[model samples]
Target chain A: MALNTQPNLFEPGKRYFRAFSPGDDFYEALIETHRDLSDEQSEMVNARLILLLANHIGDIAVLREAMSIARAGVVAKD
Target chain B: MLSTYQYPKFEYVRPPEIAEGRDGHYPVVIVGAGPVGLCTAIDLARQGRQVLLLDNDDTVSIGSRGVCYAKRTLEVLDRLGCGEEMVQKGVSWNVGRTFFREDEVFNFNLCPEPDHHRPGMINLQQYYLEDYLVQRARKLPNLEMRFRNNVIAVTPGEKQASLRVETPDGAYTLTTDWLVVADGARSPIRTMLGLDIEGKVFMDRFLIADVVMKADFPTERWFWFDPPFHPNQSVLLHRQADNVFRIDFQLGWQADPEQEKKPENVIPRIQAMIGDDREFELEWVSVYTFQCRRMNRFNHGRVLFVGDSAHQVSPFGARGANSGIQDADNLVWKLALVMDGKAPATLLDTYGDERGFAADENIMNSTRSTDFITPKSRTSRTFRNAVLGLAEHHPFARALVNSGRLSVPSFLVDSRLNTADDAVFAGNMVPGAPMDDAPIESVGGEPWLLQVLGDRFQLLHYVADAADLDAASVAALQSLAEGPIPVEPIVVAARGRAPAGLRTLIDAKGRIRERYDLQPGTTYLARPDQHVAARWRALDPARVRAAVARATCNA
Candidate 1:
C-alpha cells in the first residue's frame, strides 16, 4: 500500500469547538512522539520514526515522494 | 571470596620425552587445557587416537567466568561424558524477563515445549565445567594432560606442526600431525604464528560481580534498561549454582575500570539493585570490554584454532564458550576421519568452513545485542528508549526490544557438505540443521533421542509395520553399515516388534515421529556432530553412501 499523501487523520469536534482541521491530530501525535527527548534525541527519534513509518508504507514511489517533499525547502549549508 | 568452592590444582608431572632426552610425537596435540582443548582431547582419545593436551597453568579458570551453558553445548558435553554431572550441579533456567524502568516489559520462556532431555540453558561456573572436563579427560588412557607445560613457540609445516614447550622441570620439543590452538582470546600461539582477528571492538565497559547470597530470587535471567535503581544504565541479573548470583552493570566507556572493580564501589551498586537489607559477599569482581571478532580463517595449514582462539563475541549473549564447544564438536569427527586415512585431508577444511560460518553468526548476534544494550550515539539511545517505552504496552514494539538475543546453535543450512533434499519434509529438521530431541523407549529404559544419536554418522529410519522392513531395506542398511565411513542405522518403529538383528527404538507416544516429521519409510542421515546431512522418503543404499561420502568430503 502506498502512503496517503492526502489529508488522512481526523477527530470529531466537541460541543464548544465545532470545526474541521485535517491532519491536526497527526501533527499532535508526531509532537508527542518527541515528548521528553532532548534536541539531539528528538532528531534521532524523528529519524527512527521516519524509518518505522517508511517500513509500514513500503512503496518505493511513495517514499521517494515523501523524501522529496520533506526536503523541498531545506537549503544545503556546505 | 572463595568460601564455597576450592580451586583444585592439578599436579604437573615431568614429561617422558624430557626425561629420555628425546622429542615426543603424537597424532593430535591440543594446546590450552581449557574447556575446548580438554573436550577436543577427550573426543580424540575416545576414538582411540593418542592425544596430548598442554596447559600453562595447573588449575581451572580463576574466577566464575562463562556462567551460562546452552542446551546444544550440553548435548555436546553429554557426548563427551560429562553432561549429566554438569546439569546435576548447575542451576537450570528457561525464563527470562526484560524490564523497562520499574515495569516488566516482557518475559519469555526459552523452552515452551516439554519432553526434552536437557533444559534450555544452565548456569554453571566455568571452574566446574573445566574441572568436569579435566576429570573426564583423565579417564582416557590414550590422552595425556601436561599442566605447566607452556608452548613457547609453534612452527606450522605442511605435513606437521612442531612446538617448543617449557615445563616446570625443563624444556622440550614436540611435534604432531595436527596442532589445535585452543589457548584463548589472547592466544599466545596465534600471536607467535602471526595471525590477526578482524572485527569491531566495542567501546563500552561492564563490571561483573559474582555475589554469594542466600536469597529467594527466582532462577531466571533478569535484564533491566534504565531502571530506577540504576538510572540511564543497564543491568543483568542471573542465578548461578551454589547460591551465587551474577550481576553485570554497564558502566559507560569513560568510567574508570580500576575504580569500578573496587569492592567499595561495586558493593553499593549491588545493594541498590538487590535492596540494601540483603546481606551479600562479593565472590569475584571483574571489568571487561568485549569485542566481536574472528580470525580470517580458522584452519591455517596444519594448525587449527578452536574456541576463543578462532572467534570472540561480546558477553551480552553467552556465545563465547558455547560456540567454542561447538567448534570442537564440529572439528573432532572430521579430524578423526582424516587422521585414520578413511577420508582425505581436505575433509578438515569443511570444519573451518562450517565453524567459520557459525563464528560470523555468533559475532553478528553478539554485536547487535551489545549495540542495543549500550547505544553508541544519542539518537540510537533515543530510539532504543522509545522502543522500550512502547514495548511496555504494544506487542509489536516488544519484538524490537533486544536484551541480548540468547545463544542458540547455528543451522548450517548453506553447508557444502549437506546433500539437498529430494522430498518434501515438515518442520525445521531440514538438511544441515541440528536434530531436535524427543522421548523414546528402549531396552535400557527411556532415553532422549539426542542421547543415542551422536559421536558418529547415524541413519534414523522410521518403520510402522513388519512389511516396511523388507529384504531390500535390510540389505541397504547392512551395506551402508559396512561402507568406508559406517552409518549406524537405528530404526524408529511406531507399532511393531523389534526387527531381528537391527537396533530398534519404540516411539512410545509418537513424539519422535511428530518431532522428526517422519513418514513410514522416512530416513535421515546425520553427521557425526548430529547435524542433518540429508534425508529421503525411502531407504536407498547408493544415495545414502553418496551422501556420506559427500559429508566426509570424499566426493
Candidate 2:
C-alpha cells in the first residue's frame, strides 16, 4: 500500500502540461526503446512502457483519479 | 495494359453578332462555364431569367478534379435536371476505410439509415460533371453559352456591370444586370475588382495522379496515414467512372513539385503503391498547395462571386466543388426573384452571410485534417500518432481520427432568413436545415420527398385525417398561391388517406411521420432550395405568411 504522505499529491496518469525538461535525454531514451525494431515490436514496447510506468506508481486510487482527469479535455470547447 | 482516357474537344463557335460588333445586354451573365457557373445558368434560366455563360476554354476540365460529390450537392444538381445522369455514370460510395500504417483503424458508413434519394457521395471526374451540366444547359433555350469568349475587364456600376471580352473574332463589351464570377480560384474579375481575400496558406503540397486501370478494388473511399508503400506520407484513393482511379499523395513543402510531377518520378512511386502486377496508364498529373481563404463577401454590388472564386479550402474533405455547387443553388433563386422585382435586393445579401459562414466551417475542418495528416510540430505529431494508435482498439478514439471529415451539407442554423421556432422539434428538420427525404406514394408514381419539392417555396401542410384544418385556415393558405413569387401548397396525409384538391401525397411507410416528428395539422414552410424556413405544431396562416415573407427577405 502506498501512503499519501507529501503535502501535494502527484497524480499518476493526469495530463501535466510541459512535464519534460529542456534536456534531450528523456526524448532520446524514449526513442531508443524501439530502435531498429519492427512495427509490431515497437507497439509492444509502447504497451510495455505503459505497464512499467503504471506498476511503478502501483496505486489504484491515483490511477483512477488520473483517468477521470485525462478524459475531461478530449474535445475542445468553443 | 489500360488505355489512357481521351479528352473530347468542344467546338468553339463564333456568333455572327459578336463578330459584327453588336452590343448585347443580359439579365444575368455568368463568367466561367465550369460546374458552378453552368449550374447557376441552368437554374436561372429555368426560373425565366435570360442567362449568358462565357468561358475562355472550349473544353471540359482537363483533369479528374473534385471527384467526390456529397448528397446535398447531388440534390442541388437534381433540381438543375442532370442529377440522374451524374448518379448513373458516377461511382456512388457510402463506405470509407481509414488505415494507420499497415492496420485498418477506422471505417464508417455515411448513410446508416436507408430510403434516401442519393448516396452519401459519388466519385466522378470534374469534366464529367461539367459535361453533364453543359448538356443540360443547352436544353434550356433561355441560356446562351458563349465558349472561348474571355472576359478581360469588369466595371461594376449601380444598375448593372459592363464587361470587356476578348474573343477569337474581336473584343466586345456587354452589360449585365448581375455578373456571376465563377472563373475559378485565380479569378481575373476578382483581381480586377481588387477585393482582398484574406486567410492562411498551409505549408504543404500534394500530387494528384489520375490513372486508368482495370482493377477489381471495391468502390469505396480508402485513406492511409504512414502507408507501408509510401512510408511517412499520407495517401488517398477513390474510384471514378470509367475505371479511372484518383490518387493523391502528400508531398511535404520542401518537395520540388516540377521534378516530382515528371512521369519518370511519378511512375515509380505509383508502381510501389499499386503494385506492378496490374498494368496502368497515367492519364493526368498535377501538384497543388492548399490555402484556406475566402473573400470578404460573396456578393460585390452587381458582381457576385460563386464557387472557387469566392472561397477555397484544402481538397481533403471534397468541399471545394461540392460547396461551390451549393453556392449556386443558394444564389440562383434569390437572384431570379430580385431580378423580377419580386423581392428586395437585400435578399441577395443573405447569400454572402450564409455562405461565408459555411466557408469558415469548411476551412476550420480542412485545416484540422491538414494538421493531423501533416503535423508541423513535434507535439502535434505525437498527439496525432497517439490518437491513431488508440483508434485501432477503442471506438471512442476513432471519432478523433480525421483523415478528412468527409464533406456534409452545411446546416444554416444561424441564417437570418429562417423564422424562429416556437415549439420544440425532435428531428434534424429544424429551420434552415435541408428537408429529410421520405418515401411517398403519389398518383404519378412513388417518389421521394425531394422529387415533389422542385425549386419552389413549398408549404407542406400535414393533416391527420381528411377532416383537418378548418375552412378559415385553408383559405389563408390558398391565398399565398397568388403572389409575385407564388408558393405551392401540398397536403401530406398519414399512410392511408388522401385529400382531394391540394396535391396530396401519401406517406406510405410512415417514415415521414417518424422522421418529421409531426403530429396532426403540423405545417412546414420549405424554401426554394428545399431547406426548412419554419415549422409549427399547429396551423397558423398569419405565421405561415410571415415565414414566407421572411424567407424572401420581405418581412
Candidate 3:
C-alpha cells in the first residue's frame, strides 16, 4: 500500500474504459448502420470513424496504417 | 470467392491455405487465432470438443498488440496451459511515473508481484503472447489451427452460427454451435452484424515508437508535461524490458503524420527531451488514434465479441488489452458451462452485464486520464499546471500524480457474486465477509472462491458451524452450501485459537474490527462467486432456513 493521495485523472490507479457509451456514436451506429447512405458517404464516414477511434487511442500513424491496411485489403482481395 | 475483409489489427483471408482437409469439417470455427480467440478454442476443446482456428494471414503477427496481461487473464491462460509461457516470456511492470514538468516521481507499483502470483502488468508484445497461446492451442488434441483462411460473413441464428470462409482451393462455409469474435477493433463480424458502437472521439494523436536503447532509462515509466522536452507538448515513456522503450508524444491532433515520419521528426523530439540523450535506435513507429466505444451488446444471438471488437478504450494505463483479456476470462467459463449444458444460456447474460459495467467504467477512466493529461481547455491547463507546481514543492501535493484512479475495476456484479455480509457488500469485495476463493482439486493452481453455497446461494462466514449451528441455521447453511452448485468452503478462524488448516481472520481482540466488524458466536454467509449475502447471530434454524429457501426461489 502506498500513501493516500488526492484522486487525479492522470494519477496511478485502477480505472475503467468503454469505447461506446449512451449517446455515443455506437448508439449512432445503431441508427447509422441501420440506415442507407451512398458508398462515398459511407466510405468517408467509415474512414472518419476509424480515424476518430485511432486518434483517441493516442496513435494517428497506426490508424493511418490501419486505413492503408484496409485499403490494401481491398486491393489484395481483388 | 469469399469477401475479404480488413481489420485495424490484421487482414482476414478465407479458406486459409495452410489447413485444408478433403472432408475438413469443424464443429467450432474460430476466426483470427489471436489470444482471445485461441483461448476460446482451448476452453471449448477442453471439454472434448474438436475446434478449428483460422488465421487470415499466413502466420502469427510479429508485432506488439496487447502487451499488458492482467492477473485474471493469466489465470484463464493458465487454465489453457500457456500461463507459464506468458509469465516467463513477458516482463512484469508494476511501477508508474507521472511527470509534471522537470519534477518526476514514481507512484506505487501499478500492479504488484505478490509473494505468490504475478505482478500488475506484463509488457510483452501482442504477437509473443499470441505465439505462446497458439502453441498451447496446437497441443490440445481437439484443436486445429488454420492459416490464410478469411471469414467473410458471420450469420447467427437461434440454434447456430455460420461463417463463410474463402480457403485456398475455394470458399467454404463453417457452421458452429457458437461464435466468439475476438477480432480487433475493425471487426468485420461486428460490422456485418450491424451492432451499435457508441463513444466520443478525442482529437489528440500520438506516435508509438518501439526502440532498443543500450542504456538504462529507469525500468520506471516517465510522463512528460512540457513534452517533447523542447518542442513543447506532452510525452509519456515506458520501459518494458532491457533495451526496450515504448514512447508516446501527443501530436496536437493535426500534425502531418507523414512529415513526422521523416527522420527529421524523431531527432527534434528526442533532442528536446533527452538532448542527444544517449544512443537509441527506433525499431517501429506507428501512429494511432483511440476511441472509447463498446458494442451495445457483447452477444447478438450466438456471435459474441471480445477484445477490441467488443469494445475499445484509450490506451492509458494499458487498459485496452488488459481489460479485453479479462473480458475473455469472464466470458469463456460461463460460455463453457452453457455450451456444455451445465448451466442455462441466461448465464451468458452475466458476461455482458459484468463486463459492460467494466467497459462503461473504463471509458470514464480513460476519458478522465486523457482530460487531465491534455490541456484541452485553458482552465484544465491552469489546473494541471497548478498541481504540477504544487507537486514540485509539496511531496504530498504530488497526490494528484499518485492517484490510482485509472485502474478500472470490473468488480463482479453485486448480487450473489459478492459474499461478504456487511450490508456494505451489497457491492464489491471486502475481507472477512464470508467470501471464498477456490483451489482446483485436480488443476495445478489455486482457484479461490468466496461463497455461502447451496440452494439459498448464500454467503456465510461470520456465522456458526453446522454442528453448533442452531437447527434452522444448520439447515440454512446446508441448503446454501449443498444445493444448486457446491459452495467450496474456505475456513477463516478467529485469530488466537484458529484450527490447523484454517487461516487467521478476525482476532478475539478485534484485530479486524475496523473492516469485518467481528463479534463472538456469530456467523456470516456470502453469496456464490463470493460476496456477503447475509450475516446472522444465534441460529434461529427455521428463520435461517426460511431465508435460504427464499434466496434460492428468487435466484
Best by DockQ: 3
Between which residue pairs do clashes occur in model 2? none
- Cα lDDT of candidate 2 equals 0.83
Off by over 4 Å in 2: A1-78, B1-4, B466-473, B496-500
Clashing pairs in 1: none
Candidate 2, B148-195: lDDT as tens digits:
899999999999999998889888889999999999999989999999
Best of the two (1, 3) by lDDT: 1
- Worst ten-residue run, lDDT, model 1 chain B? B390-399
Compared with the true structure, all predictions reach lDDT values of: 0.85, 0.83, 0.57
Residues A10-30, candidate 2: write the lDDT tens digits.
345642211111111233345
| DockQ per model, Cα | 0.04, 0.04, 0.05
How would the docking of model 1 be graded? Answer: incorrect
CAPRI-wise, candidate 3 is: incorrect
Ranking by DockQ: 3, 1, 2
lDDT tens readout by residue for model 1, A1-78 = 554543344555621110111322233245456666677788877778789988988888999975764444243541
For candidate 3, write residues B1-555 as lDDT tens digits. Answer: 111111233334434333454333455567767777777777677657777777777655554445566655665565566777787767766676776556664355654323324455567767677767766776788887767677888778798887787766677777787778887888887888888888878887877776666665666666777743634567877665445667777887887777775556865676566557587767667677788888888876677788788888888756777677667666665666566665677767767777787788677667666766765654345445655655654444455542224343454534343333433322123422322223212112332221112212333344322223344433444444454343433333333322322222322232222234544445555433233444554334344444443323323
Interface root mean square deviation per prediction: 16.2, 15.2, 15.7
- Measured by TM-score, the strongest candidate is 1
> Could you tell me how far off, in angstroms, the CA of residue B408 lies in candidate 3 after the best superposition?
4.6
True-structure RMSD for candidate 2: 8.6
